[model samples]
Target: MDFTQAVEIAKHIYWIGMYLENDPFQCHPYFIENGDESILIDPGSMLEFEAVVRKVNTISSMKNIKYIILHHQDPDLAAAVPEMEKLIDRSDLLVITHSRMVPLVKHYLIRSDYYEIDKHGHQLVSGDLHLQFVTTPYCHSPGAFVTYEPFTKTLFSGDIFGGIEESWEFFAGKDYFEKAKPFHAEYMPSRDIFNYALTKIEKLELEMIAPQHGSIIQKEKIAGLIEKMKALECGLYIEKEYKDRLIHTIEELKEKDLALRASMQEIKEKEELLFQKAKMADMGEMIANIAHQWRQPLALNNTLISILKEKNQQEALRSTELAEKLQEMENNIQYMSKTIDDFMHFFHPKKEKNLFLISEVVRHTLEITDPMLKKAGVSLTFEISSEEAVEGYMNEYMQVVISILHNAKDTLLHRKTKDPDISLRLYENGKDVVLDIGDNAGGVQQENIHRIFDPYFTTKHKSLGTGLGLYISKMIIEKNMDGTLSISNTQDGALFRITLPRQSKTGKTDATQPDH
Candidate 1:
């Protein structure tokens, strides 16, 4: 029911992160005791929070642990944050982690005091222990970082050197290099990310290696483990069959690259003209859209013309009533002219980066695509929780929104989901303004989820899809605007979330009511 003993893993560092007797994997969360201040590294998951707290209490008072070092925001390593915060009655308990992760980690912690370590590396002094927080993005998480204790010369490697085990042990054996190999390959993104992590560890003057999940490799074998890790292929790199295929892909890409070099100017103009190309694509998508666009106004204009024709044919085109009929026809013509203006305005790129209300952008997109969505028999609903402005290409932003709307409409009809509905929620999250677009169509198959953003990749039929919708959306958001566009499969269907940094309200787009 209690931790057996206080096993001093290093100078002032204790092995508080324990494994369950029934559980298969060993997740080691370490504790550093320096003066009245104590730092805990990777407090275990909510389920294991009690066990972790029980162990820590036996060694020292829970109130003294002033800081928590999180390598990454994994459930196994950091989900216990909320529970742990509830037990402690102190205010200085800053959760030491990454900056980009502050918002998400706080959502779980219920508190937001943090010292984010820079990706390059940052150091903080704790008594004699100089803690190094080295960021390793995409190793496992975008905000992943491992802590190093220079005082003990022990590197708490987080999940980097983690291994698989059927039993628990304090330190890793000489054969651990082989044991940990498979774990890294499966958990880490790729060798490119793995090698980036390796480079981080290789730079450290390490005497011992302590990982959260498996055994700790001692000083004598640290170099050997490093050497083994350097040589081992993990993740996609282990797929030897893909080697020739990858080479072939590279060769094909080289030919494409040579051709692309000639069109570098047009390539730079890649997405600026995306709207016109998609609208004019030989698929006649726009032709159908134009039909929808002109449907209402044209019908009214035709009715007015017919009224005039009937009166003239009957020889009753009197001067007393002719003015009203002419005025009615003029109003209908104006409506059609406005429709053409809206369509032209949407296709032109507003290349200037300026502050524009996100809600307006979203509303305008809805206006442009409303006719099409209605035609597709999909009910579209959107809620603007609050108004926030962002700096970017307003027209380009519209393209992204429209593309997503079209995607949802297509999926809803294509999947034939009952009572097809697409819901959009716009709100603020930390420093970013977020838009959540969810649908009631069947969710994407799990197999295709990961490759959803890959260029030239699509699930729709070849004729109906070029597969560039999501790829271009991702690029425009992430690369062009320094924002994030992510999607996940929901219970109802697919959920697309776009997060863009909210710009300062310095230069707002001049006041004008939304058109539609």
Candidate 2:
């Protein structure tokens, strides 16, 4: 067990391996031999205490050990002190650690004389070897310390530069950087401790690094490694040259996303404008129908009034006939008042589904569109079916009718035919009510037929059309009112047809106007 060897530095200094070949605990102990006095640095584990004593026996010959320098109180480094004392008989000086580690070292090595080393530059002189203790706490443990020999410039770093691996090769393996990087990152207890220790070591110009569990380093690599550890300990978010490039990329993406959102918003606004235009066109057609409805009643009322004025002065005027004429005039006035009510309700904006007479909706829509049709010199015709009670949103249904009537009126006006005619037909088909509107004007263009219902797609002049009319009308009838609308270009003109369910899809019948 002669595990001691002296390197030719200044005096006889021996390096001893307590259990370098063992499985669990492997430590290297260095002995500084100066004439008669000796200093032992980290004397191996408790299990290898017998081997260390035997090895020390071969060199000293006297069973007396002078001093034991405990760098750290960790078991793997300084665990054998209690057992070593029993074998050797001498006035041994136990150079213990800092005040923080006194409790731990005292718990294990109870009878040994303790000497505390505090502060930065503390030295222990044992003949030729002057052991300068550098306080480097928090590198791996709270009571961690590194011993530097000023004579040989050899640093006994406890676990600061140590890494895990059983290989005897001192420098790390082929993938040294990769293996050593995580050993410090994952296993090191505190980053603050590592940083504080690194700052203290940077001031030292060391030539050799004899770590506790690993091989010795004696070049610029130790300093370089400590520099990197200091950088990591401070903070992991150090700014680099590539940070600007990443920021620029993020800004570009944000700008692109903003542009896309703006484009989508513009498209939505355009769609809404088109729907408004369609509704206006429908309103115009409704006005023409209203004019047609009021024409006969108003004219007849005027004629009756004129005749009554003339009869009032005539001798042939009789009381019986006067009553009949007066009663007839009263009926006409009541009819006109009813027409006004229908007109008011139809023009009102808020329109949702409800139970109402189909005939009233038709009459109100016609009243709103009649004036426009008459102004355009388009003749109106109506073939009303059975006067049945239907369930739906009144205004929405009227809007559909208005859109159809307006399209017919526009066709007739644009055609400028000698005989302009627009016809409205209503009938019951199975369980649904169907309305068909036709005109004697030229039909829509063949190529533009399919695009009639697409938003912003219109065949009329841009100033006269918003292109949303048909699209919105289609949405109102199909989605809101749960009805269907269709169009066809016939021989004479364009025909628009609409079908509505007798009962609402939701099965709830509303009898009032719906909120728009």
Candidate 3:
């Protein structure tokens, strides 16, 4: 069936493209009429060119078709160029496209005048209709663009927003974005590339979106589609590691489920003993940690006092020297105060759920731990690939980082291996934001790996071991925050990866904002 139709999208604009009965998405070709001039957009393949030309003839004369606007150089869009040239029957017919796409279009239709779009895109005026070409590079094509007609409040979007559906309606009812999500996720490169293009497109007062494939998006659904595009983690953003990480996480969760089931009865029976032991351990551990952290600063303060006393006794303290020493003391006091504040923050109970950038909190945790790591000759490195927010208790999250870090630091000291190094990396894997903390010391023993997170399981000396740290950290991450915390041995050392579901970058104001 020729089944060709002339569908009017705006006042002088028409979708005079032939419908593809066999093609699943039913690619649409549009026609824009401008007084004595006309524009043909994506005239379809050679097989459909004659049918499309015939369709256009029924509505507008072929002689008025002045230009063929190409958003990209895809064969589906430009395959008809050679055949359509025979149809145009005029040498003055100009092809509009980006310069990079010129060679491919020339290969199809030779000896044609080309109107190239610059980096900022091109503007083409057709009678009463003013068309603005907006560059949408990597919107599934290297040199793709969306034609925006301000007068009609319409956008001739080429594959930027579309979906595969059964029916071939000219305009989709309203569920366009929802239906189109899967297609975009598969086709579009990433949200980063779409962000700038979407910003430009959203600024326009658009009434309708006529895409080359699938149905059109119109009315209130325009904003919804734009918003969806803004946050979509598409093709380029999907990590190959995500699958393995997810599979491993599922196994860990199953094991934990079984362990928790078996341990709950024992935990309940020893509730009072558990509480007292936890309290004592936490108090002793942190207080000893405070001493470990404050040793250098305390020694430095004492040395400064001794120098000042000696200088005063000799009457050799100059004004400048006194100022310099006092500044040094002030800096030491500030650092000591900051260390206390960070540790305090770790212990402070979170008041409410809120969005927090875990990277910043992790950085602060590193700062509090840096002193001890340096003192123990353990070098620490932090790399944040992508920082995004997660909805949860920030203080609790900080404690988790601290707990894991302390474990790594202690292991490094315990092993007493030369040139100890800890590598902390924070990245996102499409579905979750992952924080992977690995070390250079020997990895976990295969035997002890399974029991690492168990409550009251200790492998350290009685003076230094609390075993409750990992248990408490696991509770804070999995039970309280809906995230996964797993540890495994790597080639160099042990790797502890915490996977948290990504949340809005600008966290919600459900809780009071913490003082900076």
Candidate 1 C-alpha lDDT tens digits along 1-516: 223555787777788765668565778878787655888888878766766787788778777888888888778888888778877767877788888777777667457378777733587776666888887887788888788887678888888889888776667886787678879878887777778888878888887888888887888888778777777767777677776687789999999998888688677686546534554542255446667777877787788779888999999888767888778778777866766776778666777788888888888777767778778877777776658888887877777887787778878777888899988888788888899999988778899999998866888878767777777788878888989999998888899999999976534333233322
Show where candidate 3 strays beyond 4 Å.
1-3, 119-121, 242-516
Q: By TM-score, is 1 or 2 better?
A: 1
Order of models, best TM-score first? 1, 3, 2
For lDDT, candidate 1 versus 3, the one ahead is 3
TM-score between model 1 and native: 0.47
RMSD (Å) of each candidate, 1 decimal: 21.6, 20.4, 18.9
Error of 2 at 19 (Å): 5.4
What TM-scores do the predictions have? 0.47, 0.41, 0.46
Model 1's alpha-carbon lDDT is: 0.77
For TM-score, candidate 2 versus 3, the one ahead is 3
lDDT tens digits by residue: candidate 2, 89-137: 5566465566667788887755767767774247777656677778876
**Candidate 2 global TM-score:** 0.41
Report, for all candidates in order, the number of backbone clashes: 2, 28, 0
The ten-residue window of minimal lDDT in model 1 covers 507-516
State the C-alpha lDDT per candidate: 0.77, 0.68, 0.78
